[model samples]
Target: MTRFAPYLFSLMLLFVAACGGGSDQQAEEQTADTQAQATEQADDVRTIEMVGIDRMKFVVEGEEEGIKTGEKMGDYVLLESITAEPGEELRIRLTTESTLPASAMAHNFVLLTMNADATAFANAASKARDNEYIPADMEDQIIAHTDLASGGETVEVTFTAPEETGEYEYICSFPGHYSGGMKGILNVEG
Candidate 1:
């Protein structure tokens, strides 16, 4: 009976060890899955890449660069309209593809909120040369913007879409670029 007792204790220990090891492995797997999900969510932000061409046009990457406007608003041309879900994350990357010098030709992305006067904002921005053509006083009207991108340079900005569904205007704030037709619309849908 004593010998049988030792064998029974040994079997109990092995069972406990096996069960404990399995729980630890399960915990590690769960942690790995959580980290993978976090990484995937971070990568989910949509990226929209466009180029500022010589004709004052913002052409979506891989799209035709010719000056084609879907609609014209005063001096600004609606080159494109991109859609997004409300509160979705967005990353806008703007690159300058031109042969002209920076002083002669540069570009910037200025996204204005709905209800904001885009024409007035652009006019104010045009005079803000000391501040990279971004009007400091009217910054409240802007939802997002990027730094000036000169020829052969690139600039990027990331912002979350507004919760309210509406059309937001975006334009190049370079002195005469907006008037030359460098603008688009960001439509946020419910």
Candidate 2:
């Protein structure tokens, strides 16, 4: 019995060590899984359907020209008018159709966070000629944006909606576009 005691002690120690390692591994795996789940959950908030026509109009209100407070082209799709629950996800898709060359006619969708001035954002973007009209200095204010698309081109962007429910604005920073009323709003709600 005495001779076997040492072996028993060794087996117990091994068992405990194995159990501890298993528990640690399980904890790590659980943490990784939780992070992945959180990322997926954040990906399911808002869905913004955007369409840009050669007429410089979005296809939100079922109009063809464009949505703005002006001439009769298309119904102004108010981006701020779109309200979503807090912690929701937002998916934005942009499309542009034009008969002219891409250089002459191109468009993009840029969504800005709350408290950001649309006019300033647009002005800054217009100056960024090399970065496809996206300003480097004001990158922090941008929530999500789509790549510039020429005629017959389309692009999309998906992001988690801001938790604070408020009015978020989006616009086409294509030079004189926003000033021409190429802007919309995204309203988040709790």
Candidate 3:
């Protein structure tokens, strides 16, 4: 029995080593799978561009002259109004065209979340000067916002749409711009 003990100990060591190798292989395969999944998720991200002109208008599709006064231009393209599905990904690109400087005639896109009062949000945002007209304390009410853009400059923002189906309001938040009808609605469909 003493002589056979050595063989048994060697067998146990071999078994342990084989099990360890299998575990390592499994771990490597899992890591590879996770990396592949991450790559695919990154590919799923999409981008949308919008151009704001000196006439205080946005172009949705076709040539600049094709955009009518009140009409839906294209799918997922918003000129005066925007619509989306709940939980959709949104990328807003805002470009301004004004002869004034950045400080005088800048533009930005500020999207408020559902149930947020647009008038109240715009009013509060006007008071926040250091933060570029965005209220710091009321961040929860904002869904997405772009940086301020000057004449001939552009700004962008990317965010996931809200999960609720409702109409959310968006405004320029540049002092009296909201009162001047520089506001739009983002309608989320059920």
Task: Give the number of the best model, judged by lDDT.
Answer: 1
Residue pairs with colliding backbones in model 3 are none
lDDT of each: 0.82, 0.74, 0.73
Off by over 4 Å in 1: 1-42, 63-79
The TM-score between candidate 2 and the true structure equals: 0.66
TM-score of 3: 0.65
Candidates in order, TM-scores: namely 0.70, 0.66, 0.65
Q: Sort the candidates on lDDT, descending order.
A: 1, 2, 3
Tens-digit lDDT track for model 3 on 1-190?
Answer: 9999999999999998877755777899999989856854786644445655444445455423222235443332346656777887777777776788766777788899878888888899889978999999988988899988888887988788788888888788877777766777777787
Off by over 4 Å in 3: 1-46, 53-78
- The model with the greatest TM-score is 1
Candidate 2 Cα misplacement greater than 4 A, ranges: 1-46, 61-80
lDDT of each residue in 37-98, candidate 2, tens digit only:
68657764344556676666555543332122233444434332355667766666777868
What would the per-residue lDDT of candidate 1 be over residues 9-38, giving only the tens digit for each residue? 999999988777557778999999899568
TM-score, structure 1 vs. true: 0.70
Assess the local accuracy of residue 136 in candidate 2 as a C-alpha lDDT between 0 and 100.
Answer: 96
2 or 3, greater by TM-score: 2
